[model samples]
Target chain A: MILTVTPNPALDLTWHVEALSPGATHRVPTAAARAGGKGLNVARVLHGAGHEVLALATTGGATGAEFTAELAASGVPHRLLAVRAPTRRSAAIVDDRRGETVVLNELGGPLAAEESTALHDSAVQLARDAGVVAICGSLPPGFGAEHLGELVAAIAASGVPVVADTSGPALLAAARAGAHVVKPNREELEQATGRAEPLAGARALLDLGAHLIVVSLGTEGLLVVGRSGAPVHARLPEPLHGNATGAGDAAVAAIAAALATGVDLAADTDAAARARLDLARRATAWSASAVLMPLAGELSPRHAELEAAVVATPIHEESR
Target chain B: MILTVTPNPALDLTWHVEALSPGATHRVPTAAARAGGKGLNVARVLHGAGHEVLALATTGGATGAEFTAELAASGVPHRLLAVRAPTRRSAAIVDDRRGETVVLNELGGPLAAEESTALHDSAVQLARDAGVVAICGSLPPGFGAEHLGELVAAIAASGVPVVADTSGPALLAAARAGAHVVKPNREELEQATGRAEPLAGARALLDLGAHLIVVSLGTEGLLVVGRSGAPVHARLPEPLHGNATGAGDAAVAAIAAALATGVDLAADTDAAARARLDLARRATAWSASAVLMPLAGELSPRHAELEAAVVATPIHEESR
Candidate 1:
């Protein structure tokens, strides 16, 4: 079983309007809702791929109840830890006429110290026997960078590979814990390393102890760097553009699924190198496929075909 | 006690974003939520003014639960009728830097015919001893324009003057029912009568048997037209510029309060004519005061001062 932990999650509300005019009232013909959060998005994608997944999240208040209801409706298996603060809500407005979309997100209220500790314990305990454990999303209140590192350490000690998809101090914590794989988008990478060059920032993350680091470059694609191998850049031959909201999460899900399905990660062996290349292709394809979907946490069936369309190019050490 | 009925109510979610960029993820620093709808706004304003108020709304699902929770927290007495579909949620993204706000609203799902009938019955029963009964906002699903007319007739039969704050076919229905007071904005009046001239449209509504018609003209203030008196233009000497959301609702609430407290509505008589002018000045002051607030359904204490600053100009019949 694959274990997914979302420290902070939200209910995503989406509305469509003819056009968006600032300081004006808009009539939305309809609105759609879904269970949302960085980790929840990954969990949904993994579950959709027919994997046996267990999602762990903290929920409370009326909004939290509603969020859990939506999660139940989404058919993802989950263990909810009740808390005092309501889960946050996120909204997106699509101006169909202008083809523009605006997203608004709320930072969930502070989590009690006891509840925060309970969440860490739950995540660690749930990781047992799971081939892959993916801890994703923002750190909730009462959780510092050390909290993320501690969770990673506990999970990693169980012999299960831990993948972390987060940003800022949390990403630094996961890297320090030497997470098996760390995914950081371009902006996050820059922010974490304070480096202008994506490769320089990615290298800094690798040096910080992450076994492998995948730096997402938005429409540009992924830069995969390992502690002991030539870095590679992976992308589709042509950019397949759609909604990019959950593309990064899709990549995280693909990597976690790959680890669960027996893809070797040791970069020293020739077979391991092949496994890494194969993993890169799959991650690129999954990320690309996510764009074809209108909502996050969803993947298109054409991902298999897209996998074949991905091309990974070796980046010389001198390029950095 | 002031009684307000909102057939279609929603949870208003307001997000504060540094800026809005189409198709980009925005991190909302904070989000404020409140009970929202025309009647609810007026109810809140009335309640805020220390008036005994009861707000009646239909609610269901998670969003509705949140809406009711917020209403309870607001200290407004409310009765929520259970429905099948989840309550709708509206979102507003304020771009502070640009001084602009974009709103997106979802029309709640259609109400079942039986559910609609139950709502009407509930409103009529609740109006038994209410000093003023205000039927406000859009007609929810399963309700035709005729449904509004039926509701007005029922409420009016209970010896209570029904104040309708609505537009379009519902306004037409209310007029045909001879609602004691019907509040329509300039745009609504124009749309309902297909007349560009506000006076002409006001006359048409008055001819439809409305006892009084107050046409809101935004910053231009109000145009009050009764069955007998010539139309009067009322305004604050200087427009109070602020967020205009819910300002109209405040005006409606003030007018309702004025009537309930004993402002004569016999427009054909000279004494009643003087009462109408007094009511217009008070209503315009309340509307103007609402604009000074950051939140809908709230007003600053400066309403009294603004009331003394209002000027009402008599419009001769020849203009119509």
Candidate 2:
């Protein structure tokens, strides 16, 4: 089974408003709550693609219980290590009229030292038997870049490949620790290298011990960079709109799954890129259908298409 | 004893951000959650003033459990009627620099038929034993205007005066049921009477069987109207610059406490008005201090002074 670790998961609460006028009262038209975090999103999309995925994370208090319940309802298997503080809730107020979204993200609760050690131990134990272990998202308060680096080293020692998707100091640490795959968006690459040009930054990340680097460019497509091969480019079929919340996670899920299942690095890169574009298309369609149907039922068709598309792509990369 | 009922209480979550720009990600500087609702606020404030107050409301699920825990932690006596659906949460993003607030309010979960009946029964029992009972805030989705009318009538039958603080159709129903007191802000009064002049609309409400009508005019203060008496006017000592989220509830709290303790009604009217102003002042100070300190530890020293000032003012109608 593929294992995914989300260090700081969240309960994402979304409220729909007609328009957001500052300092003015708004009556919400609708509201929804879902389990969220980059790793959790990857697990969910992978589950939709018919993969046996286990999600591991540290959870706390009432919000954590709610998050677990939502994950269970979504049919994604999860193991939660209980903690003392409540899990953070991130709020998104979507104004459909002008397509504006405002996110109010809470600084996640602090984790105890023992809890952090327990999480690293769990990751090591799970990585021992897993094909590929994906560690993603932000570190909770109290756990720093070195903590993530230690976890990457632990998993790497277990002889299993690890895929790391994060930003800032944590991403820098993961690259330095020799993560097999690193997926960072264009801005993240620029920030990581302090370079305006993403091509150079992607190569820089690969040189920093990342076996492969995938740089996502919002609607344009993705760029794949490796140490000994020419970079391959994959362009999405169509321009998409709506929330860009989970698009990167979808890409990570596809890449990790393909790599674990013996797909060649370059071919898997192309498949993963296509999978994200497909997910984006589905996510937009799902949001539109949510207007006329319950949101829960609107995305199944698109999810099925994404699942099928990822499976059809050949595993071996062919020279262009 | 004074009783306050919140049919749809919430766990109020406020995210403090330096600035909120739409279609962009923001990192909140701080986040706080508290038990909140009109009646709950009234009960808490009254309890702080050394009054015997009972808080009654519907609660369910994990959020409800947390709400109850918070109330207990604050030393407020409460009786929560369990409902089938989880209580909703109201989130606000406060922009400190611009003094702007964005509210995303959720429609609270609907009450089952048994839960509604149980709430009415609880209200009747509390009304029979308490000196004054205040029914506060909006009805949850499952309740109609007639539910407020029925609740008012039941409380009135016990010879305990009912104070209704609400707006729209619920205000109309409460008025028709002959509530002892009804407080409506200027805009709500306009909506109820379809008249731009709030005083005229307030008088019309008084004629509809409401024994007393108080119209809140934002920072200008309050206007009290009754049958066979000249309208009484009370203004704040100073203009308030903060958002008036719970000023109306504070007024209800002061009125209920004064009436229960046998303070003169006229005197209490002025006292209630002043207390409302005081609550506004304290709330502002508390919010600003909360930006720097823990919210519970941020109660302003001015609170006691404001309370004492309100107690000193006895309401006396000039024409009465």
Candidate 3:
């Protein structure tokens, strides 16, 4: 089973309005709420594709209860550690008239030291039994980069490959902790490494000890790079136009699913290179397929056709 | 004792951000949630003033639990009847940079038939013990104007004065059911009676059997009209510039508090006229004082000073 950990999960609330005016009052007839976080989204995508997956997160208060209840109702297997502070909420106001969404995310409240330690211990224990583990999303307040580094190191030491999808110092922490793979979108890569070019940013992570780096380039698809191999750039012929909120999580799910299938990436051989290329192609296709779906946790059923349409080409190291 | 009924109560959530831009993601460091509704605000105002008050409303689901928990934490005496659907939420996004707030209100989900009957029965029974009963805010989905009318009629028949603060057809229904007083803001009055002028709109409610029509005119203060004699206009010498969100509810609280003290308005005598004027002056002052406060359900401590500054003048019927 694939294990996913979201340090700061949220109860996502979405409201659709005809138009969004800066200072006007709006009446929303109905609203939708569900459990959300990058790691949870990764688990959902894998589960929807008939893969065995388990989502782990910290929750508290009434909002946390609602979040856990929604996950149970959705039938996604999950184990949540109780914390002291209430789970934060991320409200997305979708403007029907403007065809765009504005999101207001609450930075989660501080987690107690004991709560953080409990989560770290739980993630390590769960990772031992899982085929692959993915640590995702932003860390909650008081959950420092050192904590993320220690958790990733413990999970990686458990003999299971750990993948991390986070931003800022946490991204570097996961990489330095020897995560097998790390995924960060274009903007996040820049924010973490201060590198405008994806290749340079991927190199920075590789220099920190990450085995492989997968960068999601939005409509441009995925870029896969390693410490010493020809980087692969995978993209579909035409960009798909739809919601892109869950694309990176879908990419992470694809990478985790591929790694769980016993692909040996430690050896320097032609077979290993081909396996890495195949992984890159699958991730790009899955990420693109996610754009066609409306909600974050959902994936389009046309993933096979999308996989076939992806073009993976090796790029010269000196290009950037 | 005063009873305040909020048919469609909300868990009010407020978030502050630097600025609101369409299609942009914002990070809210913290957020605040509390029990809110027109009637609940009225009850809060009364309770804050050291008056005996009970707030009543229907609640369901986890959000409802949070609402009740917050009220309990605040030490507000309340009774919440359980319903099937979750209580609605009103989110206010305060733009710190722009110095404005945008509100997104969710109209509550449909209430079960049995739940509606239970609320109706409970409100009427509670009204019997209350010195003054105030029915406030909008009715939930499936709880029609007819339900409001029936509830008001039953409460009025119990010999307790009923004050209603609602808009649209519900206001007319409350008036026709012999509500002792009705408070509607300027825009609500125009929408209900299709009269741009408050005098004409107040006259329409009077013709429908309402004993008093109190129109909240925002910065301009209040216009109080009865079925006979001269209408009274009351205003503070200077407008208090602050949040006016809970101003109308504070006015209703003042009117209810005044009536609870055994001010008889049944006779068209000189004493009754003076009592009506006093009620108008108090309502105006209390409302202005509420504007000076930051949050809803809060009143400024300068209410007494505001009351002394209020000017109540008899308006000639021929002037309309």
Interface RMSD of each candidate, angstroms, one decimal: 1.6, 1.7, 1.0
Ranking by TM-score: 1, 3, 2
What lDDT score goes with residue B234 in model 2?
57
Model 3: CAPRI class: medium
Worst 10 residues of 3 chain A by lDDT: A263-272
Top model number, TM-score: 1
Q: Compare candidates 1 and 3 on TM-score and give the better one.
A: 1
Give the clashing residue pairs of candidate 3, or none: none
Assess every candidate by TM-score: 0.95, 0.85, 0.91
Better of 2 and 3 by DockQ: 3
Please give the distance, in angstroms, between residue A76's alpha carbon in candidate 1 and its true position after superposition: 0.9
- What's the lDDT for residue B306 in model 3? 91
RMSD of each: 2.1, 5.5, 2.9
lDDT tens digits by residue: candidate 2, B1-320: 89998998888777777877877778674467778877887787678767898999988887888787888888888888888888788776777777566776677888878788888888998777799998998889777689989999888877788889888999999999988878888899999878787668877887887877777666656666665434555554654554456666666765676567653343336564544444333433332322232222122345445433321222454442
Q: List the residue pairs that clash in candidate 1.
A: A23-B101, A101-B23, B111-B141
Q: Compose the digit string of candidate 1's lDDT tens values, residues B125-153.
A: 88996878898988777976899899888
